[model samples]
Target: MSRYVLERVQLSAQNHPKRHAAVSCAIGGLLVAATSALSVIQRSETVSWPAVIAVAVIGGGAWAAAMAVFVVRLQRRMKPLPPETDPARVRAARRLMRNGELGPDPETNALAVRMAEQLQSIPRWKKFTTTAFLCTTILGVLVTAPAISDGEVGKSVFYGACTLFPLLMLTVGRARLDRHHRNAAEIRRAAEHRTNTEAER
Candidate 1:
C-alpha cells in the first residue's frame, strides 16, 4: 500500500505533461497533507493539539506542493527549442551527394532544422503553467470554503476556478496539445521518409 502510494506520484509522461500537471500538482499537495495525518494511527497521544497540527500540516503542505509543481513545470514546458530530427537525413544526404549539390541541410544541420521547425509550432510557458497555480488555488479555496459563514466566499471561489480555470486550460491545452501532437507525428513521418529515402539512394 505504501509502495502503491509512492508509485502513483513517481514522474511519468502523464504526470509531466502540461494538461495533467494541474491535477497532479493539486493531488500531490493534498497527498502531502494526507500523509501527515497518518502519524496519528501510530500514536496513543490522540485527541489533542497534535492531531490538529498534523492535519493542518498535511493540508497546508499539500497546498504548497501543488503550487510549486505547476509553476516550475509550466516554466520549463514553455521554453523554445530547436526542431526534432527527421529520419530523412541520410537519404537526403545521399541524394545531395549524387547530384553534386549542397543546399538546405548538411548532415549536422538536419537535426537542428527539425528542432527549429518543432519549436515554431508549440505554445509558450505562460499558456500552460496552470498546474499548481490553478490546482492549489482551487484546493485552497475548497479547504477554506466550509468556513464561510453564509457560503459567500465558497460560492465565489468554487465557481470562479472549478469552472473557470479548468475550462480555460482545457480549451487552450486541447488545441495546443493537439497541434503539438500533430507536429510530432509529422516529425515521425519525416524521419521514416528520410530513412526510406536514404535506403533507396
Candidate 2:
C-alpha cells in the first residue's frame, strides 16, 4: 500500500511540476504584500498610510485572486493515472493526494527519495531566503530613509538595489526551475518513445 502510494507521489511530482510551485508562489506573494505594507508603515510620515494600504490591499487581493485561478487551472490540467495503472495504487494515491502528502517518502527508493528531498528543500530554502530578504529590505529602507534626509546618494543607490535584488533573484530562480522541468519533460518523452519502439520490435 505504501509502495503504491509512493509510486503515485513520484509520478505526480515528475509530471506536475507547475502544481508543486503554486503554493510556494502564494506564500511569496503574501510575504511580499506584508513587507510592502510594513514598508508603508515605516514611511508613514512621508506617505499617506490609508491610501497606501488601500492600494496594497487592492493589488495584493487581485494578485492572490489571479494566483488562485492559476492553481485551479493547473489542478484541472493534471493528468490522471493511466487506465493501465493499478486500481489499488490509484485509490491510495487519490487518498494521499487529498491529504496533500504527495511527495516522495522514506519508503520510496533511496535515490529517488534523495532527489525528492533535494527538490523539497528548495521551498524551505526559499522561505529562509524570503525572510532574509525581508529583513535586508527593511533594514536598507530604514538606513536609507535617514540618509536620504542627509542627501546621501550612495545610500540611495544601495536602497534601490535592496528593493530590486530580491525580485530579480526570485525571477531567475523561477526561470531555472521552468527550464529544468522542460528538460525533464523532453527526456521523459524520448525515453517513452524508445521503450515503445523496442517493445514493437
Candidate 3:
C-alpha cells in the first residue's frame, strides 16, 4: 500500500512538475551569489559608485534574465501545442468538454480519484516547506540586519523584497493545493455517478 501511495505521488508530480520549486531555488542561489560578491567587493580599499552599480546591475540583470527564460520554457512545457495543432480536433475537444463528455472513462476516473487522495501528501508537504522557508527567512534577516547601514533604505527595501519572494511562491503553491483537492473531489463524484448509472441499467 505504501508503495502504491509512493507511486501515485511520483506520477502526479511528473504530470504537474513543480517548476516553482526550481525557480525558487534558482532565485535563492542568485541571492547567495550576489551577497558573496558584494562582500568581496566591499572588502576592497576603494569601493567606487560605478563599481557598486555595475555589480548590482549585472547580478540583478542576470537573475531577471534567467527568471524570464525559465518562465517562457516552463509555460511551453505546461501548455503543449498538440491540442491546438489541429483546429478540427481542438473544436471537437471543446465541444465534448462543453457537453460533459470529455472526462476520463470510468476506470480512469476511479484511478485518478485514488491517485488524488494519495497526492494529498503533496499539499501538506508544500505547506510544511513554506512554513520552514518563512521561518528561515525571518531568522536570516534578523541575523543580517546589522550588516546593512540603518540609513540605506534602498538596501533595506531590497532585502524586504527578497524575503517576500518566497512567501509569494508558497502562496501560489497553496492555491494549487486547493485546486488539486477540488479537482479530486470532482473526479470522485463523477466516478460514483457513473457507477450508479451503470448499476441501474
Candidate 4:
C-alpha cells in the first residue's frame, strides 16, 4: 500500500519534468518580484519604478531559464524502476535517501537497515537550517507589513503575495521534511528490533 503510493509519486514526478520546471519558474518569479520590491522599499526616497520593473523582469526571466535547464537535466538522470522491482523495497530505499541514510545499493533491505542506524538522531545542521528559514519567513512578513498598510493597496498586495509565497514554501517544506525524518526514525527502530529478535532466536 505504502509502496504503491511512493512509486506512483516517483513515476509521476519523473514523467512530468516540464510541469515541475514550470512550477519552479513560477516560484522563482515570485521570489524575484519580492526581492525587487524590497530594493524599491529600501530606496523609497529615491525609488525609480521603471528600474525596479526592468530588474524584476530580467531576474525572473533568467531564473526561469536556469530552472528549466536544471530540471530537465535532473529528470533525465532519474531512471524508471523495472516492472519486476519490488515496490516495498523501493519505498524503504527512498525513505532512507530522504533522510540521507541511503547506502550504495538502496534497494537492499539489509543495507537500508544498517544505514538507518545513522538516523537515530536529527543532525544539528538540519536544525540550524530550519531555524534560519523560520527567521527569514518572520522577517519577510514583518518587513512587508507597513507597506501592506499604506495607501497603495494594489501594490502592497502584489508585494505581500510575492513575498509570502516563498515564506509559505519554506514553512511547508520544513514540515514535510520533519515528517519524513520521523517516519525514517520509526522505520529504523523497527528494523533494529527485528534484527535483535532474529539474533536472539
Tens digits of per-residue lDDT, candidate 4, 48-109, equal 87877887778777878887887666666555444455656656676664664434452465
Model 1, which residues run further than 4 Å from truth? 1-56, 60-159
lDDT: the better of candidates 1 and 4: 4
Q: Which candidate do you rate higher for TM-score, 1 or 4? A: 4
lDDT of 3 by residue, 1-201 (tens): 342443333333344445543555467657765774675464454888677666766776676566656544544344232321333333333333223332544333434545444444333555577777788678658734754656556555666666666666667766766676666555556667877898999
Off by over 4 Å in 4: 1-124, 131-135, 163-172
How many steric overlaps are in each model, in order? Answer: 16, 0, 0, 0
The deviation in Å at residue 130 for candidate 4 is 4.0
In model 3, residue pairs whose N, Cα or C atoms come closer than 3 Å (at least 3 residues apart or on different chains), thus clashing, are: none
> Clashing residue pairs, candidate 4?
none
**CA error at residue 132 for candidate 3, angstroms:** 0.9
CA-lDDT, candidates in order:
0.50, 0.54, 0.54, 0.64
- Whichever of 2 and 4 has more TM-score, that candidate is 4
Q: Each candidate: RMSD to true structure?
A: 14.4, 11.1, 11.3, 7.9
Candidate 3 structure, TM-score to reference: 0.42
* Cα lDDT, model 1, residue 9: 36
Model 1 alpha-carbon miss at residue 28, Å: 8.1
lDDT of 2: 0.54
lDDT of 2 by residue, 1-201 (tens): 364665555456445646644655567667657756765665555777687777677666667667766555544444433434553544543343333333343222222223323333332355677677777667767767886787867656656676667656666765666554444344344445655887999
